[model samples]
Target: MGEDCNLHEQACAAVLAPGVAVTLDISPKPVRAMTDLEFTVSLSDRNGPVDGAQVALDLSMPGMFMGENRSILSGLGNGLYQGKGVIPKCPSGKTLWRGDLQVQVGDVTGNVWFLFSVK
Candidate 1:
């Protein structure tokens, strides 16, 4: 039973792809469901913030197939990208939400997922 529970938790957790280096900041922490949410994604490397990159956000709940809720983020100059979105209310009563930031800088592409709980 414990193993099964652990597996479920892991399945619901967010995952970051290897070799991806980026930071994400979500405004209005302690995200509330059915509310407006904003996010900032910063891509960087050894040199500095990565420029000329296309970024997007994919919001979903793990372990549930409710289609894809995605948003295209606009670059705010430098390596920072900003976008606005909303966390839909889960019909299954699950409060865990995952936000996957998809980044494409030149030939390199990667994703980082951030998980948060909704009240």
Candidate 2:
């Protein structure tokens, strides 16, 4: 597979199996800081554009009395996904607000955690 290949189906179908290639690029690897929170994720097959595949964004926030949970984000056109509402602001006190972010592409999902100052 190539950068433009669809890893979702390819991963499951075994067509590009046995560690074929890693497609999908989540820009801003570390996700240091984002204001607009507008990020670009590239998902394309060798043919170009996966088109109409289900993508989901799941968010988990720590330090919440309720505990971690899943938040659904909306999808933009062309392999771009946009999260709704304002992201959790900086936390307050000695502890900071921490949470995990998960991105799903078909049957495959990836995740990362983010921490911010306490508000």
Candidate 3:
């Protein structure tokens, strides 16, 4: 839901469900293509950090075919999950990328779209 948001400068947040919220942060600011990148996803609600949730992120270039790149993140307690992935550099020199984040807790599932750019 953050197509106009610039995650390269700071963390961005989105609502995944009625009480579930998600925040995304990318390390090594000014994210670059064809490089290893770290993704941090935080899930929480009014009650505080959620725990034991499964999180997966899929990265792809919009309006372009870049193959399938998915990252499975490990739970790090307190609803914080971390994973590593890489985005291939587009031959057309485009830096815009989109992440499809899926969160599963018990039988409930939530999804969100995150728009970001790379160097």
Top TM-score: which candidate number?
Answer: 3
> What TM-score, computed on C-alpha atoms, does each candidate reach?
0.79, 0.40, 0.94
Clashing pairs in 2: 4-44, 4-45, 5-45, 90-119, 91-117, 91-118, 91-119, 92-118, 92-119
Clash tally, candidates in order: 0, 9, 0
**Candidate 3: worst 10 consecutive residues by lDDT?**
3-12
Runs in model 1 lying further than 4 Å from the true structure: 1-20
Q: Give the winner by lDDT.
A: 3
Model 1 lDDT vs. the true structure?
Answer: 0.69
Model 3 alpha-carbon drift over 4 Å, by segment: none
Candidate 2 lDDT, 17-100, residue by residue in tens: 222212222222222222333333334445554444443433334535523334444555664444432334434323333434
The predictions' CA RMSDs to the true structure, in order, are 6.3, 9.3, 1.1
Best first by lDDT, ranked: 3, 1, 2
The digit string of per-residue lDDT tens for model 3 on 1-119 reads 88767788887899989988999888878888878899999999789998888999999988998999899988899889999998898889888889999999877799898888888
lDDT of 3: 0.89
Worst 10-residue lDDT window for candidate 1 reads 1-10
Better of 1 and 3 by TM-score: 3
